[model samples]
Target: MNDTTWTTPDLTGHRVLVPGGTGAVGEGVVRAFLEAGAEVIVPTRSEERSAEFRTMLGHAADEHLHLVVHDYTSFAGAQDLVEQIVHFRGGLDSVVAPIGGWWQGSTLAEITEQDWHSAFTVLGTTHMAVLRAALPYLTDAGAYTVIVGDSSAWPVPGSGLVSMEQAALLMMQRVAAAETGSSRRVFSLVLGPVTTRHAEGFVEAKDVGTVTVAISAGPVPSASIGLHDHGEVQTALSLLTAGEAR
Candidate 1:
């Protein structure tokens, strides 16, 4: 595990889409890409959310940031959302989904039906939908990344449901990577406790974004990466960036 923060990638001229760019973690990822010179397309659930994201970005939310009102929960919805982006901007070079929620304080036996429904329906199914819908547009050379929480590895007692959904998403990306061949890549950024207004922790949102941007830019050796595993991430990014330079 490394204590140092990951560096951002040079995404000059790249076109990227972040599904939930208004949220804390999502905002960091979006900012990193924007600073890296990528034109980012963000999809929000409503005009209000789009405006909120714009306010969040402040001065950086100009020209390069394109916000669309869309839902990503259903396969059909994700498909339509992607179609809209493609129609408007031609296509995307990368797509990153930070769309997930966490809840604790209940054992599996004590978990309610609504809890189970929300966990699987939103966290599990929505990720699958994103993957299915992005495939058509994310052909050769494109990258798809999903941000995963620490509960996937370090399962908590009251957060069993969170662990379950996170684990599922982790495997989802791994499977996508294995089946993808060399055309496109599927990756996961396994995160620890992040420092967000929504949650209290160690990892900073900007640091999280740096890692996300680094991986999304390319040359990752495997499908899933631990944010705390600095050696691996840095080595891969260094090698890849160096190769690009030469």
Candidate 2:
């Protein structure tokens, strides 16, 4: 990948909630929003994880990053979290759900019930919980972006469960966008192997963040976007930026 630096738009006064802000790809999303001057709120299940995320972002993020220790995996917990955030932040402007996990080791036919539940049910429910809780409260112009892997569109051997869940999320985003009409925006950001802090791949995590920030900001070209590699990322950014300018 080329050493290209892209600019993040100014997002002053915007309030954004990132449910999976502690993960590898989520880290990029959180930092992008924080750097863009948004009031970024991250929900973590434990205090230790919250502290680690804060440290990962460093001292500069303290003023804008609000790390809340809360379990948003359950429907009730997600509702409560949304209420708390809206009450405190005045209103929510955006949500970026980069929440999910990689599953392997068993073929679809060979997988146990527990494997299926762990790999699909838990993660899918969490995404749904957050969507149900926050969708109603989102501002009219607000955006809801779901980040999933390219597996959503393709099958992976021994990881069929992950693909199933990811595909479900993609459909969820589509349904949300259609149901909401033009009143609100919903986007599915499909990514390939993301190059994060711990791994190497085609697209950088920061680029993922940049694209997400662009989507959150406005003028997205479509309800579904794919960022499989550096070229796709740049194309997405250009499209978003162009739309914003027009």
Candidate 3:
């Protein structure tokens, strides 16, 4: 996994959208795409947050970067938000939903209805809402999507809401592939822990287990920064960027 280089495809002014672009993995996606030369549009809940994210981006590449006031929690706000993003980019090419959920403290016996809903909102509702909002531009661009998900979502015991939601996302991914029929594409990168921020991102043991498999299956890039497996996350970004070209 060390000899081969997982080159991040050059975006060169390409318009790529990343939802939840201020969260843990979202920030990593933003930085990685920007480094690869895409005109990345990060949509979030507030303009203030947008500015803060811009500041987080560090250097200004005025010609190749932007932030949008896109809130996805509301069905009513979806259309207008996409309209605004489409207006900002002129055309859209890619989207990365590095958004998800995680909670380990509670066992099934201790889980509450609220816990279930909290996980659902992150893993299910958020994905549905954002995808619904962007489907227009996404279809227009030959729809490309990446679902960041937990490994435990696959038949793991006591997973509760997260598994159900991840399964739904997986079904959507497969159904989208069939429905797209070469017009568009989507994939679920059952994500693993990525070290960028202290908290990094939420990925289960199963996710990490898959990373070992991918590495064993082929060359793995050195993307982990500390205990955080940035390599896994960066590899996912590399795949999404490459999908645009294909």
Candidate number that wins on TM-score, 1 or 2: 2
Q: List lDDT for all candidates, in order.
A: 0.76, 0.87, 0.57
Per-residue lDDT for 174-227 in model 2, tens only? 898888887788888989888888888888887888888888887663478888
Cα-based lDDT at residue 168, candidate 1:
92
Cα displacement (Å) at residue 31, model 2: 0.8
Candidate 3, residues 57-79, lDDT tens digits: the string is 67843556777776666665656
Please identify model 3 stretches exceeding 4 Å from their true place.
Answer: 1-6, 60-63, 105-110, 121-123, 139-143, 152-159, 200-246
Model 1 has how many clashing residue pairs?
0
lDDT of 3 at 85: 68
Candidate 1 local lDDT, residue 88: 76
* Estimated TM-score for each candidate: 0.88, 0.94, 0.71
Return whichever of 2 and 3 wins on lDDT.
Answer: 2
Query: Residue 97, candidate 3: how far off, in angstroms?
Result: 0.5
Each prediction's RMSD over C-alphas, in Å, is 3.5, 2.1, 7.1
Best by TM-score: 2
